[model samples]
Target: MEADTYTQSAFEAELPIPRGMARIMRFSNDQPTNHVFRRGAHYWLDLCLTPRPEKARGCYSERWGPHRFERLGEIFLVPPGEALHVRTDAGDNQASIACEIHADSVDHWLETPLEWTDRRLEGGLDIVHPYIRSCLSRLAEEMRHGGTGSAELAAMIAGQLAIELARYLEAISESPITGGLASWRLRLIDERLHRGGSTPSLGELAELCSVSIRQLTRGFRSSRGFTIGDHIAQTRIEMAKRALASDDSIKSIAFALGFASPSSFSYAFGRATGVTPLRFRQRHLRGRE
Candidate 1:
């Protein structure tokens, strides 16, 4: 429950935060700030107030991929005891309202052990979830204009946020197709695909993992609910997303990813993401702006 407001100067004000309760704080600054906790005891949700071309980077257990604040709202959930560092270089002020939900509150809602699990909204952070957005806006308004019922209202909203987060975590935790591939094997395959290497056939994958084709297929299907071919297709699609986010041409991306033709690539991409390659790139480019 500690924060550091670092700046080039020395002017800071203590926020009137209710101890051990959920609260929101407005953050808008050009400079970056790293907030460290000796031991984190809260689940934090940050809603971006201004969309930035360069998404902010945070380091918890690992350095996550670069993420843009989609127009719907970009949210991040921080787990207990994990230090948080926020780097904002959007060329303008990065404005966002963050809500802190204490661990005890989340524990009351969730029965699972979540001591080190941090999560963010998946699928490019373009979440148009009405409830999450509305709760953030209301909490910000209440914090801005405090009154007798403001505290109660803020607490209720924070509780709802915690509930939503717990539900999402629990749902995702119940994934049926996890822990299928070995970490090393998955990483090796991911590297080869992401580096624009040729797609490996079933035989090649079997040799790569030192397993027979039949064994590989059986284990992978049982673990991931998808065959090796499907895994490769999905990996290539993810690589296509990264390439499309950059200035790479669709044709070049298709060729580099080993797609037989641009049309084939389009079909596969649409099937994987429900959108065409051009559409995915266009959406990302718009988000950058």
Candidate 2:
């Protein structure tokens, strides 16, 4: 665990004026002084964060949840038109670098509108979510070295980040079809498929939801985008992908996912995914670029 504590210098003239489309700035053992701010048009962000070096203390900002608090390692996405108060810090240890970006850099990929508000990653950052952290680090490097020619790089990085965020949201949505709120059936279905393929039959699914097949199907249609069978197929393929990564036998994999016969599983996997199971595994593993 780390504590935040730092006294910042008095307000400097407002932040980067005539905001550059891409800007690189680093903060070390520093705090941002109080000021009112709102997201203007066009913005993306990559912040390098770490535990505060000094004591944990204060911040009075809507950019953060209100509190005289410790600075945690998280990033804020200030979208256009969102208002925020950048507050004074009461922490003694804090260090971060922010690469502020404009929306023109990522408009096409905005999936869930995780825009210009304070979005906090719970607990500590998952440096191992390589798809995400790698892009953030890459964006930082581009901001650092690309200099004035960083716009193109920023746009590229924004696209990658947006996709990762979409995937995360997708995962969240798909995790509660059987055991969540009534509105979350689709999400649960999607999450199960993503997790390890569906081992549940219609009877099993209905039992899990404590409903009859007819009623569940009606409700699921209103919520889940795909039928139970289709979703199961999707989940099975995803699981097969992971299985393929290992040296497991195809027959064994088929049995593991509840296929009655290896041939049936391979045929279904190939027909739906356009590649036989073994081929899919080899291609993905051999071509992991």
**Per-model C-alpha lDDT, please?**
0.56, 0.47
Question: Residue 1 of candidate 1: its Cα lDDT?
Answer: 35
TM-scores for candidates 1 onward, in order: 0.47, 0.37
Per-candidate clashes, comma-separated: 0, 26
By TM-score, the best candidate is 1
Worst 10 residues of 1 by lDDT: 8-17
User: Candidate 1 on 1-289: residue-level lDDT in tens?
Assistant: 3456333222111122333433333344445544432237766666643343243555542334334222222555556665554555524333456666667776777776653422232311323333565666566556546678766666677767667766655544334444456757755665665577578888887788887888778766644333567557655765676677767789998999898899999998776555588876775554444
Which residue segments of model 2 deviate by more than 4 Å?
Answer: 1-198
Can you give the lDDT of residue 17 in candidate 2?
17
lDDT of 2 by residue, 1-289 (tens): 0112123322211123123333333233344344443456644343423222222232325445666343322333344455443444443322233434455544545455542212122111111234555556565456435666566666666567656644543333332234322745545554655454337767767766778888767666434332456546545654675576568899898888878888988998765444578776664453332
**For each candidate, C-alpha RMSD in Å?**
10.4, 13.7
